[model samples]
Target: MNHLGDAHLRNWTLRLAALLAADTQDQLAWLGERELETKDVVEEVELLCRVSEGLAERGAFEPEDLRDLRAIGRRLGEIDATCRVGLWEYALAVDPAWDDIRSLARQFLLTRLGDWRQPLPRPVRPHTGDH
Candidate 1:
């Protein structure tokens, strides 16, 4: 997709994320009432809601959640590259704000998936008397 399209998608993603984080019921009502410009956009919005709901219910995203999101993203990307979802690299290249959103999403996923990179407990060092 072109730069303009990318910008619009990024805006929509941010807006949707905000709505999802704020109040899901209101967001759903808002979506139901609005007339979206395109079917692809509507599909994307619905998909976003589904993903957000799934993540919320699970308390974080699992590997399957990532896979599902990627699959949806790939399908949407076929419609327009900018429509791609769950792609951090593309998001970072297009918009700086996406970094924050992506970071939160990543943390959620990592928490659910188990963060193995955390350091193990170490023994405390004895204090020396010499000053």
Candidate 2:
């Protein structure tokens, strides 16, 4: 077993789980607090899609979890296919597809990790330069 690989998997899993855990309103507020944008949220989802390509074989995720993961990815693909490039900002806030993804994420978290009952932690932004 690879500890480094496990750590990497854990980090990305938690990030994807966190992104899915919050609804639009909650996510908006979380990003607002961090001075971040909706693109950042989308970026996280994209990153997860790339990272989890063959993640299940690593033994970090259970079979059911992989099932849910694929479902989430499929819906996300639809969201991407339907949305116009420039319209994502508006869609992220208004699209029902995102809500569907969130629901799937919530279920995954509930059964595998936990529920979204707890408040999310603050995102950490490294200082870029002297303030």
Candidate 3:
């Protein structure tokens, strides 16, 4: 891979990592600092499902990463929130029903790349090679 290709791969991992981490309150606050609101986990997790393809193509994902991803997906799938606005939006932060999702996300974030409790890179706009 050339420099640009390598950077592209790196971006995918960071984006995937961010999507996973954004589920937790700590990471949510971190994203807030960068003006990145990744709180709508229903949408973000869906985005992760697609973005992970790029990461997989680049051979950037670990075996455990896929396992953890599926675990998170399965947990979200179990939610039966009765709101058309969106499941995560329906399950507010204080809602006990949302706890499992956040806990799973926090575990995945830490297991895959350590959580926000560790130092993280300053936020960068994901590169799509387009304006």
Candidate 4:
């Protein structure tokens, strides 16, 4: 993936970790209400949530844990691209004029990636509209 896409995925991974640290009921309720733009997003979130719950129960991230998290990040990056494509399709279907709205939504999603502390390998720059 490109740099921005990779950063977004890393951001999402951090966000997932934050969610895992939060209350389970709150996380479930939040996920339940989100208007995911595609089936891939829904599936990815469910899968990640399950994994996150498991990891939380284990109490710490080991080498294998980091590997699992990296895998999740890669998968999320794939799904994120798919979701964006789906969004574009919907935009085209509804009205081409909605492109600006779609752009804003995409940016918003990127921004929502979370405020968790940076994870390993390399640091992710804060998302600040540079993309």
Candidate 5:
């Protein structure tokens, strides 16, 4: 693997973390209707895993880059789990009936975010150490 800059790794981690937080917010909002399901959560988790794994596989990244990605994944998982539990509270707050449409909306938003964060097919790698 190529050596990725520390700055690059940090930036990626921060970006992923932010996205995860945003997704959690959206998810909770949808869960207000009691539309959340185990399948939905699993899909979100899979998306996160895929993105982290892809970043690690990028040939330009160093071990540190992968490590940073793993750290971000850990944080994201925590946020996701918390949001799931909070979903019940949110549903109570809204008093909305959980329905199939609400569940679909949640899944759609998460899928969109995942697609947005997906790395390009070909990543650009530095030829050598920075000048």
Candidate 6:
């Protein structure tokens, strides 16, 4: 297999990032505004899973990265179920803020899966005696 160049990797990464951001925004927006049924959540989960599977097969990501993507899908599945429960129990009265929570969670999951490295944690400076 040929090694990917920096430009190639960057292009793919940026494209995937943009796609994810848009997808998350749309899904979360809907989730926030409506009390979705079980069937609705299931369909969304299926769509996300299909994308994740495609990403895994692209070979741009490592094995661990694939695992992270799958894990995110699973966790989102749980969140979808929770939303369904809330819908069933509260009807339209259910708070839509769950959209923000799920959106943030999706961002976290993407950051973990993406190859963008974070800066190293800052080291603690030695304490000075000055008050």
lDDT of 3 by residue, 1-131 (tens): 33466566545545555544454464455455343332455556656655555565566666676666667667656655443143333344545545665566566667776762444446566566997
* TM of each candidate vs. truth: 0.26, 0.73, 0.53, 0.28, 0.29, 0.35
Scored by lDDT, model 6 comes in at: 0.45
lDDT of 5 at 39: 39
Candidate 6 lDDT, 1-131, residue by residue in tens: 13445335534433433333334344344345444454454355445545554555565455665565465456545544455553421422353434443453346445654533222222234456877
Residue clash pairs of candidate 2? none
Candidate 1: stretches off by over 4 Å: 1-46, 51-91, 116-131
Which lDDT value does model 1 have at 55?
Answer: 51
Q: 8-46 in candidate 2: lDDT tens per residue?
A: 875667666766677777766655534444455566666
Can you rank all candidates by TM-score, best first?
A: 2, 3, 6, 5, 4, 1
Worst 10 residues of 3 by lDDT: 82-91
lDDT tens per residue, model 1, 28-129: 344453433334443654566355444534434345545544543444344444443433333334543434433443443344334312222222244568
Q: Against the hidden true structure, what lDDT does model 3 obtain?
A: 0.54
* lDDT measured at residue 76 in model 1 versus the true structure, 0 to 100: 38
lDDT of 4 by residue, 1-131 (tens): 33454445545645545443333344344455344344544355546535544443454333444444544444444443434455323423453223332333233333444333222223234456975
Model number with the top lDDT:
2
Against the unseen true structure, what C-alpha lDDT does each candidate score?
Answer: 0.41, 0.66, 0.54, 0.42, 0.42, 0.45
| Clash statistics: count for each candidate | 0, 0, 0, 0, 1, 0
Off by over 4 Å in 5: 1-19, 23-34, 59-65, 75-131
Which pairs clash in model 5?
Answer: 33-98
Which lDDT value does model 6 have at 5? 56
Best-matching candidate per TM-score:
2
Residue 106 miss distance in model 1 (angstroms): 1.4
Clashes of 5: 1
